[model samples]
Structure formats: C-alpha cells, structure tokens
Target: MKLQDQPPLHLTYGLSIHPDETWPELWASIQEKALAVRARVAPGKAFGLGLRLRDAVSREMAEGGNLRRFRQFLDENGLYIFTLNGFPYGRFHGGRVKEQVYAPDWRTEARLDYTRRLADLLAVLLPDGVAGSISTVPGSFKPWIHGASDVERITDQLARAVAHLAGLKEKTGREIHLGLEPEPGCLFETPDELIRFMQEWMWPRGRVRVARELGCSLAAAEQKVRLHLGVCLDTCHVAVCFEDPEEALRQYQAAGLRISKIQLSAALEADAVGRAALARFIEPVYLHQVVADLGGGRLRSWLDLPEALAALGSLPEARAVRVHFHIPLHFEGGGGLRSTTFALRPSFFRALQNGATEHLEIETYSFDALPGGASRDVVESVAGEYRWVLQRLVRAN
Candidate 1:
C-alpha cells in the first residue's frame, strides 16, 4: 500500500525545546520558533504540534479566550495540536530539575488535577476526527513509594485520571488518552513493570472504578481502561535500559496496551574506552540516570550521572553504560560518546511500518544542555530534526 493510503502518523516535535513556562513566552515561541520551523520543513502541509504546557500555562491557555485565539493561530499558520508533554508539571529548565521532576506524581490529587486541565485544553485544541494524547509521569519516583499502601494510593489516583479521561470521551467524543511515560529510576521504569501494573493494579481496581462511573459492565470497563490508559514509548529511555524496541513493543501489544505516542530521541552510550569521555554530560539542569551493565546479567543503576561517574572505576565488570540524555535524532555519536541511535532507528521504523501509534514526536528537549548548544539556533535545530524524521519515514515507506 502507498504511504498516503495507510493511516497517517502525525509527525511533530515537542515545544519543550523552547524553555517557555508562561503563555506569553509560549505564544511568542509559536510565532517566532514553531511557525518558522513549520515553514521550513513542511511549507504548505498542515503541521502537527506536540505541545508542552506547564500547569500554570495550561490554566492560562484555558482562560481569557486564549484557547480560541490559539486555535485561530493554528488555522492561520497551518498547525494543529495532536499530543501534549504533560510529564513535567513545573519549570523544566533554567534550574536544577533532578528527581524533583517527578514530583506530584500520580499519587497526588495535584497530578490528577493538572492532567485533567491538560485534557480539557487538548479537547478544545484538537481538530475534529483526530485523537489526542497526553504523556504523564510513571506513577511516582520508585524510592518514594515504599509499601503496599503507597502502591494502592498511587494506583487509585491514576484510576481517577483514567476515569476522568473516560468522561472526556463520553462528553466530547474526542478520545483523548493518557500516556504514562516510563523512565529509568522511576516507578514502572521498564516494560515488564508497566505490564505488571496494568495486570495487577490498573485492570483490577481501574475496571471496577470505571465500571461504576460509566455505568458499564466489567468487560466494557476493561476495554475503556485499555483505550484510555497507554504507554508513551520514549526511545531514549528504552535504549538506556538496554531494551530491545521490537520485543518491548511486542510485549505491550500482547498485553492489550496501546502505544500512545513514540518519543523519538537518542541516549548516550559508552564503553570502557569512552567511559571517561561521558563526564562532559554531567550537567546540573536535569537528572541523568545511568544504567551500567555488568556481566552475568547484572545491571548497576545510579540516580544521577555524578553517582555513576564516581563509581565508574569501582565496577570493574562494567561493559557498557547508557545515560538518560536526550540527544539529537540525526546525530549518531560524538566526542567519543556514542548514541543509541542505531538501536532506536530500526525499532522506530519497525513501529512506523507496523502502525504502532498515530503520533510520532521528535523530543530532543535537552538541546541547550548539549555541548556548544547555547549558540545554536533553536528554530533551525527543530526544523532539522523534523526534516530528518520525515526523510526516514519516506525511505521506510
């Protein structure tokens, strides 16, 4: 079948690359950066936007007729929003984000409120007949959630979010899904953990809750949970955990889970020779969780790059280390530090070929943290990533 005949995968890049937390800054970015990028890469074609709105900005967009105005801007500029990066709730850049990025995780009412607001905004912004996705935190930070009660509390909160989504679908008929994006050192970091959550927590408790709320049978409620709650597969996070993308995707599919959105990104990989070279990646802005593979299937994981670097020499059996760093999609490796690009590309293309999801977002949100990135033009960089992915998709087709 021809590419146009198949279901169209909405290709776009996340707006998080621009460190704008307020509405004015965000609107300026759309006009100055987002529009310019679209003009260069897509020209007259309708460009999709993977919007990243913090809690404050989300509230701002929903009020004062901002949503209507923004929709008008999208129509005039040939743009539309298909997905949102709801993972980060507060300021993502210009500060030390560290483990705090996962604060107000699925355990709290605040997370639920924030996500509900995002869904409300997305429902208004999404064009007719197009489904939308909002990628959120993977429960809470693993270390913080101690025991059975913690798990139950977090799961209950998440169920509330899922129930809210079901209500939105019933009310708006837009079918917006919440994608729990898994990352290293967080709850449900790997595919297996995510699957287990679905079977143990989500399916059991969520089905009953949804059934009661929607007044449907258990089977129908189960189906609703499957449709609304899904995974946002971040290529960089999967690669850093040394997961085979094809196998992971297969596992998610087998579990009746939907792939909400594919976050197209690359991670930093290093062997012993290149181990010392990764020191340059030690930045203060975000937490760079590093997973070191020891022989005999043992993996040593650290909370941050500094911890990993400090113990690099002690782990003599360490063969390779993958850091949670979002690098440009087009660049493979540099400065003796390799990227998991090779592993990511084939798997991403495989998913594309199989129609894994409708949304494909290039999410290299760490451009400013990259070496010599301060001088780089954000608009051109975003446009370049879009062009690179577009070319790859065409070739894959």
Candidate 2:
C-alpha cells in the first residue's frame, strides 16, 4: 500500500489574552503584551492576534484616526489580527462580570448593533484574501429566556445581523463572519442543542427575514445566513459540558453547519479524589459553570463552582466534574488535578490538518483566574502555549 500525503495546513495560532478595560490601557497592553509574545513565539514573522475589543474600546477603535493608527501599528509589529473575541461587550476585567457577560443578548438591538460594528471593523482589518470571524454569545443566558417572544426576538435580531453581514460582504468584497460560542449554561450548551435551535427556529425564521431584506429567494437567504454565521467551537466549553471535541465536530459537520473558528483550549477536570483542589479556582471576576456526570447519562450542572461546592453534600456524588476554567494548553495539573486536554483526540488534529477550519486560536482568556497566574508572566506563558500547539501541528503532519 502507498502512503497518501496530508493537505497543506492554512492554520493561524493566537491567544485571546487581552485583559485591559480602556483604550489607552488596551493599546499599551497590546503594544507590550502582543509584541512580547510575538518576539518570543514567532520572531520576525507575522504573528496572528486574537483581538479582544471591549464595547468602549470597540467604539474607540472605530473613531477617527485610531483605526488607521492601529493598522500602522500592526504593520510595524508584523502582527495580524485574524479573529475577535466578541463575547465580551463590556467591562471584561477588574470587576465582577459573572452572568452579566451574557446580558444584552441576541434578543436586543444592542447585540445586533455591536456585532455589526465588529463586522465592519473586521472587514477593514482583514488582509486581502483572508477571511475573518468574530465569536459571540450563544443567544441569551439560559435562565433569561422566559417565553416564545424572547426566542422570536433573538431569532429576528440574528437574522437581521446575518442579512447585514451579507450586505457587508457584497460592499467590501471581504468575508467577515459571526460565530455564536456555546457555554456550559448558556441557551445552547451543547452542539446538539445549538443545532436544534438553528434548524428549528433560526433557519426557519431567519430565511424569511433575510430573504425579504435582501430581496432574494428563501433558498439564497438560507445559504447566505449559513455562510455568514456559524459555530465558534470552543474546546474548553464543550469539554466542560462533558462532550468530546471530535464528536461535536462530527455532529456539526453532519448537520451542514459551518465551523467559523476553533478556540483551542482545555478545561480543568477532577474526580472525587481531586475535588479539593478545585477550591483554588473560585474567584470573583468571572463565572465558572460546572458540570458533573452522575453516571447513566444523568448529568447535573451549577452556575458556578461555589454553588456546586455548596450543593455537593445534598446531591448524589458525581463520577467527575469539569470546570469551565480555561487552563493553559501546556499545563497538565498535578496534585490530583487534571485538564480536559485528553478530550482532544487525534481525529481532531487530523481534521485540522485537513483544513476542517481555517482559524485556530489559543484562547486561555482566564489564565488570570488560575492559581498564581497573576505573578506569572502572561506573555511568556502564552508563548509557551503557542509552541505547544505549533509542535503538535508539526507532529500531526
């Protein structure tokens, strides 16, 4: 038998590690942090950046002179932004974010307007012939959707955004897309749930609105919506929900859904014996949704680690629990703690090697929430993760 060659990998590696809350501060952080990572990780090369623009900073970046100024900075530094973390619309750090992160969800005009601005900004930033993607919230927070009106509102809003994106592509001659990211407790926690929402509500409702708005046939509108909007598959989120990344990828592929990007990250996991170590991760800054498998396909969840800990005595003991803590790719926990990196099987990497998705990001956004992360040099830590992923890609080839 003869060996077949692997297809060429058109992959880009990055870290969505920006944590600043203001424009000047963010610019300084990018100039310092992004450049330091580049110098250490891909010296003298085009380093791909996963830009995190807060709502205020997004406005600032769009204002006069700043956009061009930032583009000049990118040119000088040999850094390129290939993706934006659109999930955070405001105040990402230095305050308690919690579930408020999912506010102004897909049901509102605010979410649609903000997403449209990002699409406009990304279309300008993307290099010629390079497609762009923005990962956003998965509809609304699970607890907030009270009835059919909310679902209908979100469906119509997203369809409007999809229509706007199609118009942007036609006007700019660039393809900038939106990827709804699913979290453990969000409206669409699992790939199965997300696809169900898409087929049942989004596709059926979106096609009509999109077709009417674009003055096109229903079939063309569905195709356009699918092309411009898709899944931003976050490995950590899916793993924390007790789902395998490869299996989720297979599900997405089977459903005729597009994977706009893949956030390469790992979640923390521990069995009954290692449960004590999870206490160190409880913090005030962000919500860390926890999911536990109680055997026999029975699963339970809590909004945060503390709630899970508080209810542990009353509920049946779980076989294992996974935390939505974005652990560094290179870190396998000691002291009875482990990461869900094991869930990233060989098939996932093989799919990447075959261009399953064009965008790959090292999204350790919560490194600061990890134990001793504040004292660690984030740029150096991210650079190590960049090496970890690059080496894996090399070995996979």
Candidate 3:
C-alpha cells in the first residue's frame, strides 16, 4: 500500500531493536542478528531499521558515537532509518532504569527547553526526510487528557515544540515529518481529539488561543498559531481502546492525515465461552494476517492456513500467503496445570489477506519493559517469533 502519496513498492518492514541493546557489544550482536534476517527476505522488497532511544540525553551522551556508527550500520546493513523511539522517558544510567518526566512543568518553560534540546539532537542525528513518532510527552498524560492544561500554556508548549521542529526542517533542508501519536492515556488520546486539535489550532496559518474551553476549537478561537500535526497509528494503543483496526485505518485515511506508521503487533485474544465473550478480549479488535509464499514459485498465491496445509500442491511462481495473529500475551493457570503463555490461532492468519497494506513495522518493544533480568531473553524471543512468521510467509507465497 502507498502512503504519503509515495510509490507502493517503497513499502517495507523493520525491526525495532530495544534501547538496552544500544551498547557496543549488544549493538554488534543485533547487527549480526539483523543481517541474518535480511538474508531471508526476497530480493526487491525493501526493508528498514528502527532504533529505540530510552533516554534521549543519555543516548546523546553515552551512545553518541555509537549512534553515528549505527547510522553507518544501517547503510552497511541495507536498512533505512525508520523511527527514533521516544518513550518511557528518563534516565538509563544504572540499575532501575527509570521512566520519568524531565519536564514536570509541561506548561511552563521547562517543557520548551526539553523540547528544543530533543529537537536539536534529533535534527543532528536524524537529518531531514526522516519520519518520527512522539509519544506521551509529559503533558500528554492522564488527567491532562481530561481538561488538563489551560489554553494559553498548552498552546505555548505546542508552539515551541512545533517551532523548534520547523526550525530544524529549515536548517536541515529535509522535510522531517512528525506523527503526533494519540495514545490512550495522553492529553490527545482519540483520533477525533487529535484531528480537532490539528484542524482548529495548529495548522490554521495564523491562530492564537487565549481561552481553553472544553469543546472550543483552538483555531476558531485564535489567529496567531496554526498546527501542522498528523497521526501515528499504534495498533496496540488503538486495540486497547476497543477500536476496530480496519475501521481506524479507514477513518484516518479518510481524514487525509498521514498514517505515520502502522505498528504491527499482536493484540490479546481472550479465552472465553463463546464468540461474543471472546470478542471482548481482542485488543486490537482485529489483527493483520501474516502473508507468505511457499516454494511453489508464483507472483503471489493467496490461501487460508488450514486449507493450504491440507491442499498441498506445487505452484508456478513464488509468492506469499498472509496469516493473522493477535497480541498482548495471554496465559492461564488452573486445572492443576498452572502456567503462563500465549496462544496462536490459525484464523488470525486467515485475516491478513483482506488488505493491501505495503509497509509494516514490528513493534513488540513492550518486552523492554519486562522485569529486569528478562531483557535479553525477551528480545531474542521476539526475534525468533518474527523469524518464524517470516518463514511461514516465505513458504506460503
């Protein structure tokens, strides 16, 4: 599928390497791992690389050179710079890597300073033509979504950040696109709220807000500031809100806002008594099916999983069949069989064949937040899972 009016073939899928793996040794290991991954994909299907930054400042300091090297790594490895992670913000100095807001006063001067600094760093490392995703900026949290900041202050914060980003664009001569992700707990939670913010306040050319009313469109009220913001589709975040994945895609697509990124991850499906009961547990409400091509040599052969397994035959071209998978780890403990884990369903595999989505990014970064000791193993597990899916895709197509 084409996005940003770009060619469809520019589509690709990338892996987000955890921030913990940013060090030299781990970074090298990740390169080796990713190399193995690249060797498996078809010749012309473009792919990319995603770098997750834990603490922007710390990464700038400790891994600055490493960062540069990583960019070179991307080139050497045939991967494009996909995303620069900005989440669980805070320090990663020692044990207990904390997630804190450096800007406790998001409405005041602190937030601007932080934003400027971050924009500055990102501009340097991420030049222009780079697409970025911003999640849970300090003021974006809980009560904030419920009428949190006064109009003047929120507007100011947004202005400064936007200005800084714009300034970076001029300096770099690159059209860096920012996807203002509407997360579940942030101030700009829903698509409606975010879209309204963009249309009303931010992008109106000249708009300035003096009063922040519950439903007042910022642009209608102000003439000094205009927002140039767009949307970032985090499937898991949307899924948790019980929104239909396909419907969400269509809505945003209709809105004319960029689909910054389509985060591919499984949503949890519940173990229930029936279909209705089970429906409540689907995190994304719906998930994309994994499509692959088996050795049968064809352009692309589409087939459902169980049926394909049963009707094994040779093909004229090498193509892939898609399969659906759900996310959010599910486990059970009872009946004298206490255990914790996830379940893979074949039907989930059947669903992906419905769309023409070209680019997809594997976003299983939540594993980074797992209990302390499990980081490495968890990352490896995710890698293995992706490889398994890729193998199946290869076989089916």
Candidate 4:
C-alpha cells in the first residue's frame, strides 16, 4: 500500500494542536514548533509532520520561493511531511469559529482553488515516491446542504479537484489525494449518509463530470477520482457519534472506500451527574456537537454542545453523553467527566497495525483551553499522546 513514505506506520503531529496563532507569524512558528516537538518526541529519528494550512498562508507559501525554502529546512532537519489538515479554510482558533469553519465549503470555487494550491505545495514538499494526503471538510455543515443542487455543486467542485490532482500526478510523480473529513455536525456525519453520498452523488455523477473535464474515459476517470478522493476517519469524531472505530473502519472498507488517514483523538464523556461540570468547556472557538444516549439502543443528537446542555432538561432519560470536544488521547476523568479513549480498543490498534492506512496523525484541537490543560506544555502533551498511542500499537502487534 506504499506505506514506506514515512516509515514505521507514518505517525505525525497536527500543528493545529497549537491553534492560537497562524499565518505570517505562523510561518516562523511552524519551523520552531515542529523542531521543538521533534526534539522532545523523536530526537534520534526522522520526524513526520501533519501540517495545517489556510488559504492566506497557502497563497504565501506558493510564492517567493517559500516552498523551496521549506523543503530545504525539512531536508536539513530530520523531518518530513506526509499529511495535511485542509479541513479549516481559515482562522481555526483564537476567535468564534463555531460553524463558520465550514464556510466556503466544498461548493465554492475558492475551496477548489485553495485545495489545488495545497496540492502544488505538497507536490514539492513530499519525499521521493511518498504519497501525500490532504484531509478536508465533509462537503459542508449538514444544515447548509439544502437540496440536490447543493449536493450537485459540491460533487462537481470536488470532481474538479480530483481532475487537478490527476493532472498534477501526470506532471509530477507525487501521488497526493484529497480526503473529506466527516465531523459530528457535518454533511456526511453518519456512515449511511457518507455511503449514500459517495454511491449516489460521487460515483454516478461526480465521476462523469471528472471524465468530461479530464478528457478521459469513464473507467479512467473513476479510477482517478476514487484514488484521489476518500474519507479521513477521525477516531474522536466517530466516538462522539457513538460509533465503534473498528466497525466503522470495516463499513468504510466494505463500501469500497479508502481510509485516507486516521486522525487520533479522544472525545469527552460524562453522565448527567457531570453535566454541570461540562459548563467549563463552554467556549466560543469551536463547535462541540453532543450525542445523548437515550437508552434502549436509541441516540439523540444535538448540533452543538451548548444546545445539548440546554435541552438536557426536556430530553428523554439518558445514560451518558459524549461531546465532540477533541480532548487529549491521554486524558482521564476529572470531577466526574471522563474521556472516550476507551473507545480506541485493542482491536482498533490492531487494525491500524495491519496497515488500514499509511497516514496516522495524532490530532486534538484547542485542548489547551480546557481547565488545567493551560498549565501543561504543548510539546510534552503531544509527546505524551505519541507515547501512549505507540505503546498500544506495539502491544497490539
């Protein structure tokens, strides 16, 4: 499966973990922060970077020989990039990002242009014969997709991206693919929804569009689209929706979908007793979708965490609640609240060890905003997560 890109299962850190600053300043921040994390985590080995870039930074990096300079930097250090978090179009933190993070969603030409720029940058940055992956938003927020035309527009835009990627591969030998990352409140949050969208919209119409655009046969276009487009299986997001990771991976594979990358994160969980403690997490930066277990194999979902807390009084009797907050993988209970790390069972690690995907990115957003988390060091925290995950992976093997 071309897993030799960044060997040893290709584990990397999401620069988004330090989400407070980006662009201009972030350009320098990345060089320093990446070196810092590498020194603490894997001082003696080559470090893998799961980079994040927004439209503005991407534009800057594309010009002025910046791409070449960054490549030189990586080559000088024992560092390499295998994956990118392209989900956030701009400004992921330090303000009210809430649902606006999904803006300029897959339907807009802006999104398409931004993605192509990233591909160009990655084409130069990737190592020889190493495949690259970019994880993007899941079409759009679920509420934003109103009708068939919206779906059509999103599909058409994505097809254009696939065609661009195909052309890039033709010119450059780098094989970079785009992955649609499904979040709890996004368009393809559930397995059935993702399957239906791919089978109905992408497979039938999107491929035809790609074929026409690329001036290739339907079969050739289909192969290119499937090869370049797939799902970014996020562990915390699936857990937030009360879905099993191993089973979810099985469903995706059974549906003939590729696991572009696996984002390693842990969600927050608490029962009714701890509902009040959850108030501490009420922030304006990110959307925390909540899923309530209504018992008898039933689940009720809220688009945001605050909404779930507000409706908890009127909702049916519940057993536990899982929040979309991407807590640190090593996080445990505190004042009645706990982590969903348990969801990442031994089977999950086993599946990963068996080459479910070549890209493994440890991802958690704005965890420093949590209580007591602010006091912890970002490098140490991320290093701790790497240690924890690597231990489990070794045990599973």
Local distance difference test scores for all models? 0.86, 0.84, 0.43, 0.85
| Residues 2-114, model 4: lDDT tens digits | 22333336888788877524455665656667677777767768788888898888888788887888889888887788888888888876778889999889999899999
Tell me how many clashing residue pairs each candidate has. Answer: 0, 0, 51, 0
Please, what are the lDDT tens digits per residue for candidate 1 over residues 263-318? 88889999888898888888999999999999888899999998899998988789
TM-score of each: 0.96, 0.95, 0.58, 0.96
Query: Mind giving the per-residue lDDT tens digits that candidate 2 earns over 1-397?
Result: 0012243223344434665678888787778888787788667777667777877888999999998988888878776776888898888778899999997799888888899998888888877767789999999899999988888888899899999999999999888788989998899899999999889887888889999999999999999989988899999999998899999998998997888989999999888778888899999988999988899998889999999988765665688889999989999787778989888766678788776777888888888888999989888888888788777766775
lDDT of 3 at 276: 26
Better of 3 and 4 by TM-score: 4
What local lDDT score does residue 330 receive in model 4, on the 0 to 100 scale? 90
After superposition, candidate 3 runs with Cα above 4 Å error: 1-29, 39-47, 56-70, 91-139, 144-148, 204-228, 271-359, 368-397
| Candidate 3 TM-score to native | 0.58
Model 3 worst lDDT window (10 residues): 335-344
lDDT of 1 at 282: 87
Q: lDDT: which is higher, 1 or 4?
A: 1
Q: List the residue pairs that clash in candidate 1.
A: none
